[model samples]
Target chain A: MKKISKASLSKSFWRWWYGNLTCFTHEHMQTFGYMWSMLPIIQELYPTKEEQAEKLRTYYPFFNTEPQIGCIVVGITAGLEEARANGAEGIDDEMINGIRAGLMGPLAGIGDSLIVGTYIPVLLGIALGLSEGGSVLGPIFYIIVWNITSIWFQKFIYDKGYELGGNAVEMIVGEQAMAFRESIIVLGRIIVGAMAGSWVSINTSVILTYGLDPETGDKIPVFLQEKLDGAFPGVLTMVFVLLCWWLMSKKKVSPVKVMLLMVILAFVGVLIGFFDPGLSY
Target chain B: MSISWLQAGLLGFMSVLAASTPAALGTTVGNYTLNRPLVASLFVGLILGDVPGAITIAIPMQIIYIALVTPGGTVAADLRAVSYIGIPLAYVTCVSQGLDLAGAEAQGIAGALGALVGTVGTVMFYGTAMMNLFWQHYGWARLDKGDFNVLTKVEVFLPIVTHIVISFIPVTILVYYGAGAVENFKSALPMEAWYMKALFTLGSLLPAVGIAILLKSVINKTTDLIYFVGGFALAKSLGLSLLAATAIGGMFAFVNFQIAMASYKGASSGADDEEDI
Candidate 1:
């Protein structure tokens, strides 16, 4: 019984890193990359060509997960393959593939919330500040910080997954992971809200003139935006965002339709002398 | 001064290369960040010898798509084409029109142009993803033959080549021809036209769509909507920066998380065999 070498582990890790580079479609998502990543392990564990081919075929199922955090699944499978090669009992193809398939959902949920929802927004917030002043560090900071953190964290989870094997799934879906995911989800929601307020620009500049000024005998051009802001700043932006959300989420209207709706609204608003580009807050 | 035909062609070629880099490099050398309009503008600036101006133009566009996150293969917009193909064309149009690089008008023009380019990019994105399906079929055919050695090509090289082929023509033609077309259209068409004014007006509002798409993805719970409205109130009332608001939100989430965790522990007993492991 031969154990997998360090060199083969590195090759597998590299293959896993490029998992979503190609052939990603609605059908069999990440299947080809999963199969590719396991090639080195399959080759090392099974000496015979028939055995290698059979083992490799097991990874061809519809395997999709957040590729960065999903490396844990790949790493755990590597450990299981090593164990099975040493003639371990109770580990079959279904068990291995089942674990892979199972972990995909939870890990994807956590990874998407943490990485996409929280981290990227926070980083972009910082980057936007830096870039507004015409600083080159904006892009540079984003590249360096994002790559280093993601790469280091991914490697840590991959090694941990290998060590834990089947038990990793239990640990992942356990109380601690749930707490962590929920906390981040809360944080992410807050940040996204903050972002929406700051970033989503919508304002109206239409002025209502009813009465004349007593002193100057002039028409008092009452700006509607000032009154709206007096009530709640970014009120129009919030309303627009909610409208778009309702259109997409509740009404099942496509994003294209929503976008077209905005365009038409903008056209009518501008033609009626209500909304202007300079009116954005 | 407007760019020459040769410069436009060269920039077009570079744009395609830059646009495909994120997919081609595949996270090895920080290509994900390079996929951004800010970075794309940097490279375009370097090539065009106008770094500051390009970066200035790209900053606002970058802000519009700052929250973009494409999870589960569902993309809202493709910023790659906007960055590589659109920014360069916008810059060229600015130069041709003698627009001030520092002015709001310049930024608005570039942003509006980017929004238009990004709409087209959604098509290119689906087209590329759809084309890759053919390659997946090719891999399945090879896999069925029991030849596992070709899997490397299926993962890396084939996809890179497929992306380059799919992205090159549109990027080249759009950047090269689109720049001149914009200039021609601008000279003939009056900016005071109601439709033209409306188009710029619409561009200013397009960022709302980007933000809304993000909100749709992240807002799952009913109670979670409070944090969103709360954050908005905080920003509007206090004039808070995003970082400051996020920090305050983080503190609230920590307390909320502790309570939730405690309840979760109380609800489930230790002897329960729910984990199936």
Candidate 2:
């Protein structure tokens, strides 16, 4: 029985962790990184240089995904490669590639939505609160907490993947996992909304009418912002956010274009007295 | 408020590590951690000799890029540029113009500058990725001949050269010289100028796009807007903080999880009973 050593597994994991996207390209994506990571495993399993190179070539196919959560795929392949070396039946290049291709798409979606979309935002939201007055606590808190949790989660999933092999797919895409993912997304939506309210501020500078004071001969302008706030607080901000969402999501306009449109809108709004920052120095 | 060459060099080196798509320090430590505007604010503050001022300027920039999910490796705004180049430029602009770092005007200017540099950074991001093709191709040729050791060289060391050419030099030059340009621009255009007013107005309005980009990722269905609107109402109407809103949102998520799991169990058990029969 040819068993893969713990040292080789650790080496493979570290290689994947650090080099997964280091040499990323549009054409090859993570293929090179994948090969670099698998080299340790191949070398341990096959003593000869030719045999090791042949085994390493199994990862030459183009690969890319949300690399953080994509660690599981690498772990699964490591286990599969070990099995192949051990003369296990039905373990071939086709089977290994099949597993990799199948897992990348779903894992990408989960990683992008859960880890990047939801989790990081929540951490950042809390950090933003702590950073209220430019205190270093916010960044320091985020740095320590994020790095610790991220590395821990990546390592945990990686180990689980190696232990369970192909069965690891069920843990991620299973119905129960889907439920968990949906619930987390619910939390993400709510948090994003709160982030919008707490951070985004869009006020109108348009004045409705100027009232003349009889004694003092001063003009007291009736501001549009106050009137809008009386009806619905931050209505203008919500409108703009939704407008940008509609333009991007529905109309399929890119974010950069939306930003440019905002610039134009700002210019027009400033010209028409609809928006002003009231700045003087 | 001007950035010294030494400070600019440090910022340049950090940018190379923090570049998205192919960060030298890897993704977790480099891109996700250091590239974040809030985190970068601390380092920029240290470099610029004003921690509070840098963080103050970074707040709006952070909001504008709160959830920069580079799905499929396509980035809307590169944070390396936003955090490093944008924050420094915004800081200099604020200080030179005598604007309060914490004020709306300053925040607006920072947002505008961040968005501008972030867009430019996208080009730099693509440039680094393209340059890496040379190294990857070289690795591929060597692999064809069974030269396995070349993998390490291609993956690690060669990419550093790409970073130096694409990321390091441009960032250092832009930041070093951009400070003086900001000072000149401040004197030329007074705060009340129409263009300046428009620029700040644009700044205040840009975060909506960031939030919208975030909303695009979560809102797969129209009904998801309810949760978003509810969260917004909780914060805007009730004046709740982000943590308070998160606490409330957590309750909803828990309830949702329970209901989903219960339904799934019921369906599965029903299937099992039918099979037994």
TM-score of the B chain in each candidate versus the native B chain = 0.86, 0.93
TM-score for every candidate vs. truth? 0.92, 0.95
Residue A44, model 1, lDDT: 84
Best prediction by lDDT: 2
> Relative to the true structure, how large is the alpha-carbon lDDT of every model?
0.74, 0.88
**RMSD of model 2, in Å?**
2.7
lDDT of 2 by residue, A1-281 (tens): 88778998888888988999999888888998888888988999998988887787788888999999999999998888888898889988888998899989998988887788878878988898899888999999999999999999888888778887887778878888888889988998998898888888999988899999889999999999999989988989999999999998999998878888998998999888888888776
Model 2 stretches astray by more than 4 angstroms: A210-219, B270-277
lDDT string for model 1 (B24-91, tens) is: 55643323566678777777787778887788788768767776656676666777688877788778
DockQ of 2: 0.65
Point out the worst 10-residue segment of candidate 2 chain A by lDDT: A163-172
Give the least accurate 10-residue stretch of model 2 chain B, judged by summed lDDT. B268-277
Query: iRMS values in order, in angstroms?
Result: 3.1, 2.4
Top candidate (DockQ) = 2
Q: After best superposition, candidate 2 residue A201: deviation in angstroms?
A: 1.2
Error of 2 at A196 (Å): 0.8
Docking class of 1: medium
